[model samples]
Target chain A: MKAIYKREVQSYFNSMIGWMFTAALTAFIGIYFMAYNLFQGDAYFSTALGATLFVLMVLVPILTMRSMAEERRSRTDQLLLTAPASVTAVVMGKYLAMLTVLACPLAIACLCPLIIHFNGTAFLLSDYASILAFFLLGAAEIAVGLLISALTESQVLSAVGTFGLLLVLYLWDGLVAYLPSTAGGSLAGLLVILALVCFLVNALSSNWKVTAAVFVAGAAAIIGGYIAASDRFAGLLPDMLGRFSLLGAFDSFSVDHVFDVRGILLYLSLIALLVFLTVQVVQKRRWN
Target chain B: MIEVKNLVKRYGNHCAVDHLSFTVEDGQVFGLLGPNGAGKSTTMNIMTGYLAATEGDVLIQGHNILEEPEAARKCVGYLPEIPPLYPDMTVLEYLRFCAELKKLPAERRKEDLDEVLSLTHLNGQAERLIRNLSKGYRQRVGLAQAILGFPPIIILDEPTVGLDPKQVVEIRSLIRHLAKEHTVLLSSHILSEIRAMCDHVLILRKGKVMACDTPEALEEKLSAGGALELSVRGSAEAVRSTVLTVDGITSCEAQQEGDTVKMMISADGDAREALFYAFAQARQPILEMRPKTATLEEVFLDLTDEDDAVAAQAAALLADTPDEAAVQTTDAEQEGTGDESDL
Candidate 1:
């Protein structure tokens, strides 16, 4: 695992991806810092970080597109897979390497809070906390990009797919606002979401019987609960999905200046889930 | 040693490897010979733990590949069909990484790296990037990586596919050298390479094992003493009469062309002297009397070709010999040993 991690990290810097990612991220953060803090005389560094989240949606894919896709394309995965290393080790090694590349810009951005403190009154605790949240947010997004990369052998498709998913995640809060608030509408939306999950389960397991059982059980429970307490179903669909807005959790720190432990747990759990899925993707390819 | 038991790999509707079973004894150079799309690469991939078999298991040194992959993979080093190289790294860097990946002892890695470099003749190319090297050199780098820890089993898939004649000879000798201490399993479609390098050959066709025996045994079984071609300057009837007079000639085929006769005689034993004396006495001057020895090329073509008649004929010849008994007895012994090792 260490060997793979070292090689991946070295290869990122050996190519232009590492430098370009760090430079682009730092430049965006700098531009936002100048406009929000320097010229506007805003004392808070979390505002600049909040503005830089858009840069991450575009550049995190650049850091992660080549992680697993290039290995499959060049057939180098054979060496790693056939070696003594387990698939989990290989995936973790690569994920950690991408996380390390992300840390470079965050490390540079750490200096901005100090500059603000020297200039005037700076909320040092909140600024540092927001930076930590920003790092976790980017780390979670990189894990998502890694999973998408593992699903295909073409780097272009991985990049495009990750960007599309990240754009949806970035706009997740607004998208949930468009959902219907009526009880019947929420129940219909829940059924649709349940069906989509069943389809995904069928695709992964290729077992229709298991998917059908899960779908039937879930739909029955949802309907039974709605009949028992009809008022609980009103405005439930949008509120439940709105809780899944990943960026909304990060905004608790960057915008509201609150250390939300539940949000950090959400980010960490998402990273773990995506990394596990990526490893499963690689393992399933061997059997297929 | 390696054991592949009833291995089957199905790709949706198409089966790439179907009910294949084989064993490689310790210190033997085993060859998987097949034509294109014959599942040679697929089997190698499964054996090396790069892929999983659909309905069977592979055991390397008593460790099941799927159940204990790290233990099984530690005992085998694989050079895949494409070499599996990182072009950006230099030869030295790639080999060192492989050494660490294989978990070679830190103190001995440098010595092992040097030994592998000199063994593969890559000492001079160590500083060069793999992308800058030729295909042959890249292959050598791959071989060097596989040989780094000196694993007991080395599996190479078409190790000499794209090389000059000299490099081909070099790689063949290197494989032979490795076989002195390590069990080597390699795949190739080239019959001559199998005949030249393998102690045991497994012939595959359409994902099925056609024949599994040593090269000499396969040839002997397929063509028991072979046939003989004779050219005599005589009438066709006279030549046929002379050939018929020779004892042990099971079948004689004669063709006539204007005072010259060509005959193909299948004999259970050496009937060359008998035919020569009979032809001389009959005044049929023999121009050519050469015993036709079946080459491995003919055996491979007959076994793998799509023509059912030729395949049936070869199968019939194989049945006439006691080769299947030998195969079965060894298989039973392997099962006994496998059970004991499991305990």
Candidate 2:
């Protein structure tokens, strides 16, 4: 695992991807910092970080588009898979390598809070905490990119797919607000979601019996709950999805000026789930 | 030692490997001989744990590849059909990374790296990026990667597929050198290469094992002492009578020419001498006569061809000889035991 991690990290720098990613990210952060803090009188580095969050939707894919996709394209995955390393180890090695690349700009950004303190009155505690939150958010996005890369062989497709998904996530909060709020409407929305989950299960497992069972159980549970207390279903669709807003969690530190432990845990859990899915994708290719 | 048992791999509905089974003995060079799409690469991939078999198991040095992967993988080194390499790294960096991945002892990695570099003749190109190296050099780098830890078993899928003749010979000799201490299993569609380098060859066709034996046995068993093509300057009756007098002639078919007779004659053994004397005594001048011994090429074509009758005949002959050949191999191994220990 260490060998793979070292090689992946070295490979990132050996090519132009690592240096370009770091420079582009840092440049974008600098632009935001100048606009919000350096030029304006605002002393909170966290505001600059908040303005820069949108930059990740474009940059995270650059760091991760080639992570697993290039290995498949070049057939180097053969060397990794046939080695003594497990699938989890290989995926973790790659994920951590991308995290290490994402860290470079963050490490440079780490000085911004200090610069703010030297310049004038600064919210040092809140600013450093926001940087940590920003790092986790980027790390979570990188994990999502890695999984998309694992799904395909073409790096272009991987990058586009990741960018598309991240764009959706960037608009997640606005999208959730458009969901139905009435009891019958939310119940209908939940049924459609249940059907989509059943379809996903069928595609993944290729077992109609299990998918059917899940659909039946989910429909029964949703309908049973709606019938027992119709009030509970009102606005339930948006309320549930609102909890999953990745940016919402990060906004607590930068916008609300408070440490949101649940948000941190959500980012960590998303990273773990995406990494596991990438491993499963790689392992499934062997059998197919 | 490596064992593949009742292996079957299916891609959708097409069977890539079907009920294929073979045991590669320790310290021997085993060859998987097959034409394209014959599942040679797929079988190698399964044996090395790169791909999972639809059914059956691969055991490497007594450890099941699926159940005890790390233990089994530690004992074997594999080079897939295409040499899997990262083009961005220099040759030395790539090999050192491979050495670490194979988990060679940290203390001995430098020594092992140097030895493998020299063995594959990549020392001068060590600092060059793999992207700049030629195909042959890249192949050598892949070979060096596989040989990094000196695992007990080495599996190579078509190690000489794209090389020039000189590179092929060098790679063959390198494989031979590796066979002294490590058991090597390599696949090749080229008949002569396998015959020259392997102790045992398993021929595959349509995902089935067609024949498994030594090269000499495969050639000798399928061809019944060979055949003689004769053109005699005489009437068909006279030529036929004269050829019938040969002692060991098994079957003869004659074709009439303007003033000569052409005959294809199979024999139990060499009957050229008897035929010559019989034609001389009969006064039927022999216009042309040439003995045709079946080469491995012919046997390979017959075994892999879609013609069921001829292929079945060759397969039957192969099946009949392995029992005898098995005993002979043990005897040969017993004789070579002294040399084996010296390695």
Candidate 3:
């Protein structure tokens, strides 16, 4: 695991992806910092970080596009797979290496709060809390990118796919707001979401029996509950999806100056789920 | 030691490795010889745990590869068809990474790295980036990586492909040296290389094992009906009439060039002396006489070639040999002379 981690980190720098990612991220964050805090005389550092979230959507894919996809494209995954290491260890090594690359820019951003403190009265605790949330948000996004990278062998496709997903995620709250809030519409939406989940389960496990059972059980429970109490179904779909908005979790820290513990857990769980999926993608490829 | 049991790998409906089973004992150079698309690489990949078999099990040193992959993989070193290399790394760095990935002890890692480097003759090119090195050197780097931990079993899939003649010879010699202490399993399509380097050869065609034995044993078994080529300074009709009188002669073919007639005689036993005496009595001088022995190339072609007459002859020869039901089954099934479902 250490060997893979070291090699991944070295390759990132050797190929200039690390430098390019860091330069682009720092440059954009610096511009936002200058405009929000330094030039506009705003004392809050969290607002600058909130503005820099868009930069991460572009740069995080650049950092992670070649992680697993290039290994498979070049046939180097054979060496890793045939080695005496487990697949989970290999995935963790790569994930940690990508996290390290993300750490570089976050490390630089740590100083932004100090700069704000020197310029004016700064809420250091809340600002640092928001920075922590920002780091976790980036970490979760990187995990998503890593999973996308593992799904394909072409680096360009991995990058584009990750960017597209991240773009949707960036606009997740706005998209969820457009969802129907009526009781019948929410019931219909929930059934479609349940069916999509069943499809994903079928694709991964390729077991029709299990997928059918899950689909039937989920649809029955949702329909029974909707029939029992129609008022409960009203606006339930949009509310549930709104709760899943990744950017909304960070908004508590950056906008409201409160440490959202639930948001931190969401970020951690997202990271864990995506990393597990990446490992499964690699493991399942062997059987195929 | 490795034991492969009824290994079957299928890609969609096309079976790549069909119920193949073989074993490699300690300290023997085992070779999988086959034509292209004969499932050699797929079998190697499954054995090394890089790919899963559709239905089978591979036991490495008593551990199942699928059930206990890490332990099983630890007992073997595999160099895939394409050398799995990181182009950004130097040869030395890549090897070091491999050494660590293979879990070599820290104290022995340096010594083993040095030993493999010298063994593969990559000491001079160790510092060069793998991307900058030529194909041969990159192959050597891959070989060095495989031999880093000095595992007891080393499996190479077409290791000599894409190499020049001299490099092939070097790699062959290196493989021979490695076989002294390690059980080596290699695959090649080159008949001469298998004959030169392998102690046991398994000939495969279309994912079925046609024959498996020592090179010499296969040649001896396939060369059942001896053939002789005789050149006589006489008319073709006269040479044919004289050759027909020889005992044990099954068939004779004569071709006349200028004043000389060349006859190819197939006999169940040695008929050289009888043919000579017949020519002597007829007053027709025998210009030249030579016995034809089957080369490995001929045997390979006869077994794999789709021509009806040649395949029939090869099947007849195999059927004549004692106690090779597997070979007979494959041959008979391929020629449609046996039950088709037996395959």
RMSD of 3: 3.9
Off by over 4 Å in 1: B224-226, B231-263, B278-289, B322-343
Alpha-carbon DockQ of candidate 3: 0.87
Top model number, lDDT? 1
Q: Candidate 2 at residue B14, lDDT? A: 99
Models 1 onward score TM values of 0.92, 0.91, 0.94
Residue-level lDDT tens digits of model 1 in B49-113: 98999999899999999999999999999999999999989999999899989999999999999
lDDT by residue (B1-343, candidate 2, tens digit) is: 9989999999999999999999999999999998788899999999989999999999999999989999999998889888999989999899889988888999999999999999998889999999999999989999998889899999998999789899898899999999999999999888889999999999998899998888887766644344778899998887887888878777888999999899888777678888889999999989899975456776677667655665665566566653343223322322323311211
RMSD of each: 6.4, 6.8, 3.9
lDDT score, candidate 1: 0.89
Least accurate 10 contiguous residues by lDDT in model 2 chain A: A198-207
Error of 1 at A80 (Å): 1.2
Q: Per-residue lDDT for A77-194 in model 2, tens only? A: 9999999989999999888898899999999999888888898898999999999999999999999999999999999999999999999999999999998899999999999999
Give per-residue CA lDDT, model 3, range A81-122, as digits (tens).
999999999999999998898888888988998998987899
Please give, for residues B196-219, the per-residue lDDT of candidate 3 as tens digits.
899999988778777788999877
